[model samples]
Target: MTDTTAFDWRSFLLNWSGEWADSLPGGETRSEGDEDARRARWLGFPPASEERIAAAEERLGRRMPPSYREFLKVSDGWRHAGGFVWLLAGTEDAHWHDNESGLADMFEEHLDEDAGPEERQEADIWRRGLQLDVESDITHVLMDPEDVDENGEWAVYTWASWRAAPPERHADFLAFMRDMYREFHSLRAHRRDGEPEFANDTTRKLDAQVAQARSAALRGDWERAGKELDEAKGYGRPRAAGLGDQIRRLLGQTYMVYFEGLVTDPRYAPELLPPLVAEHAAHSYRDDSTLTFHLRGAGEDLVSLAYATLERVRAGTYRYTAAGPFGTAVERARELARWGGTDEAWRTLIDALPLWEPLGPDHLAPLGWVADPVLGPLLTPERGRELLSTPRGGRTGEAPRPTAGLDPGGLAWLAEPDPGDNPTSYRFVLVEGAAPEELPERLADGNGGGDGDGTVLNERLTLWEARRRLLHGRREFSSYDDRALVAVGRAGSGWSFAFDGDPAAFDRRRFVSPAASASAGSDTRAVVVWSGLRARHGEPFFHLSVARGGAEQYAFTYADEEVRSRGRIPQALDPSRFFGDGEDGAEAERSLLEAVAGEFGVRLPRHAIVNGRLHTFTTRSWTRPPGDGETYAVIHLRGEADRPADDDRTADDDRTADDGQGSR
Candidate 1:
């Protein structure tokens, strides 16, 4: 049943032969110099070079079969004188056997013809070998010292030898290798279309399972169908954990069919229509170059589907796997349905699914174990009721009253109450005297319900208003006459605090260092710098400078390198942790106050850190128990004194501070 001409021993021997013995098909094992052995040696069947075989065996870490070495003597070429013999073992083509002279001629001819191409081919061969070493290489086998029996010695188990075993063993080895190769294959096949079939058994199996699932569904076994489909999805099949996608497509159609039946007969249970409606409403997406798609919709769909699928199984229409998505979906859906969808229920769901946690590399949908994106909105009784109500009148509907627990005035004064009793409105409050036109462009757009054109003006206006109120009642003076003077506010951005001396005209102007220009993306929040001091004339000095550039750029600047270096000002501040989409603007404004306080050695009760891309801060209002004391003090790295007593040797100020009691 086999073709002899198809077997090219010369190429086969050079390529697939892992063992030297396997390279020698048939050869005699007679003792050296024996007449019978010499004759066999001349026929291409000769005993192997004992020394070479033993050394090769030692290096290879495996025993050589005797039959292989025996076949190599006459085949060695230089030893056999005249026409010789060529023998092959089981399954080898017998016609390849020929006169030894002809075999030798063929070998020499190939060597002469292939020299140049062989060199180029060898480079490619080496490259291929290196790749193979990376992919599915057994060199990683480590003999675990702890797993050794009794003694401290370890055993070298051979994955290769096991892999090369007979068909039955190969099947077992395939299973082991499949798991072992998962990571390697993932890298090679990541987002790569057209992967070879042999390397992608997982995907193949999943496709087959999808087919099987559809078949099961057609036979009216909804649970069996859903379970099979879920298994294909659970192992991260069809590129990432693709459960939602399959369920949506399969169950969407299934539920639609059920809906047709329900609408026709009111007794058909309106309960099932919700799941069908939810699935249809959810978003659906397909990844580039992938057969799988996701039902990317609101998490409410997950609850509906999970509940419906579970109820169907409970009602004896479907069967399921205990640990799969269908199983968990069922359990969760039942809980939400039974509890009447409370805040506690949504909280439990959140405890299971945290926001932004990825499901899988290729999966866009978060696993059911995690919470949904619109979790906060979903907690509302109105939304919850819409998601949980059954079609028929099994559960009663008694809506609760609004404003159930607080005085009308108190409720009005408090920022929106924690989401309870169906509260769902958001509002913003502006600081007093805040300019109506200088707000940050984005804020203006967000507040005025317009594009971001005039938001920056609005933001600046607010800052001016707050600063004007804060600076009120402060002392001011004229140059010659003892006339009462005022510091008027104007439009513009940056540090604008007033001081006894003209800070704007101070010599040694601070310029933006080029190095500071390197970072340009961190401009979310403005950094405030303020200085308060007392001069020898007994006049209080105050200065303020606000950085308007991006936080990515360096924050501080001074004319003297020594001054800038010694001050220890932070070069950049990431505002991500301070503010988020939720909550009132109080938190961000409070953070702005703290940054200003830190530069002036003013003690404050709050601290702020940017965490998870939000500009969040700890403030007096944020403290668990409101108090009057400054729990945390903000101090400049360099204290309020312009210069240390020992270091104050300035050309102009040397005589004034000699007594070491400089003005406070």
Candidate 2:
């Protein structure tokens, strides 16, 4: 028998058998020898006599490692060491690896002159190592006698062909066996078969550890919880694996977590399932890392049921039946969904998540509802962003809404311009004391100028035609070259107008404000206004920024019914008053434009912008910096630039001129 004070081999074997029984299905009786062997694999064979061990040692001319000998005193051999390894050899079967398999010849033949000392040592060790595994699936367990330590324990290695990795080394046979036991647990954790009840003391001890870890996690002692769960997991407890994953996710170490085993009890399913389903659906297609549910057994069926229920919720045919805060929240969400207020309903559910409590120790409560059956299908992807867009405990107060309006003054034309197919998305940069002809140069210098040979072309076209040409350039050459086009002209007496049709251009507050500041001449003021009639998601947006003396003075943006402002916004141009209380998004946007135009004393003649000609230039404002080992090529497509003679100067020519000027 093994010394209980050291390693209790009998108890370890018993725990291993219990875990094996819990994982694998039972009741199939095989023929005599096969059945006996299979039974012995789990329960283990009787301990070998001292005389038998001595006879085997005399035959092999080497004494067995202390741990291996002690293990033999408990059980002669082991079986199913892990997923890959099969039967471990007993005294009667153990032999030298090289003598039996002759694989040392293959290792020597492949050994290179440049092989490192460690590699050479590994190859030589394999040649004389004692084999511990008598049967395996392309796997071998070896003990190196020459690598004995002070304790007289030989170094052990587990090599598998399918791994394509070097042999995994362990300090001794005991350590190898312990790792194998842990591997068995990890592999079995994913099984679809039922987990049988483990009545063993070791299992009870591990389960208790997991329970304590859960309590610790709830008390916010996450570090302690993680350590405890990690320890329990080492003993092959599936509950520990599940709880550890949850702790990792809660601590922000990972974005995904998983639950194993069957979860069909109605008491627990409601509290446990929604978050897992939602998180799984949310990150299913994520590119960075694989996030999965890890659901097995009846858990799979439960997920399928949840999906069906979600479809019913979307169809307005499902009703939550349970009582309590969560059920009430669900009902509220259902009512909102029925009334076409899905986003509001989703918010209602999300707000109530913190109040959710677990029904059992195994359940993790208050997960996101983005994938909940009753709310997930109703929540649009755009709205679902609310689930993780902000840090936990960081959100407070109601979202900002547009409640103010700005007076149009002399710039009323901006609020009511010619509408049909007019460039709805555009930006205007107006610099005082900068002539119309010099506006392009100022902007080119402010932004990082392009890189190409000097070639400048001046053309005049209506704002509509200019926008079309810019869009055409974007579609045609965007694959090889990043480019944009801007129409420059005199807006009023002292303001030079630079307009871009791309809505996203100068959309970023930092970029637009800095660009405006850079465009201002010494002691001169510059103003930039960006307006988008309808974004890709159908939301209108407006932004205004003012710069003076080579620095930005004020900036404001109003989008998605929210306002963001920085610096000292003039009271006359306060975005809160830029829109009337009853105004829709489009009207609000127009009102904001009028307010900006009036504040900056900027006015663009409608007739000139709509029909008259204006000087247009191509800019490389959107070109991305080249990555490592990356080069760019410019290809001018034939028949694509077939515009009027006045529009002959392509974006490429202006980029080359800008590049030349920037170089100087």
Instruction: State the lDDT of candidate 1 residue by residue for 479-591, as single tens digits.
Output: 11111011111111321111111121222232222111111224423322222121122222222233223332223322221223323335332233333455233343335
TM-scores for all candidates: the values are: 0.21, 0.47
lDDT of each: 0.27, 0.60
lDDT of 1: 0.27
Candidate 2 pairs with clashing backbones: 404-576, 404-577, 404-578, 404-579, 405-577, 405-578, 405-579, 406-578
Q: Kindly provide the TM-score of model 2 when superposed on the true structure, using C-alpha atoms.
A: 0.47
RMSD after CA superposition, every candidate: 24.3, 17.4
Best of the candidates, TM-score:
2
The per-candidate count of clashes, in order, stands at 39, 8
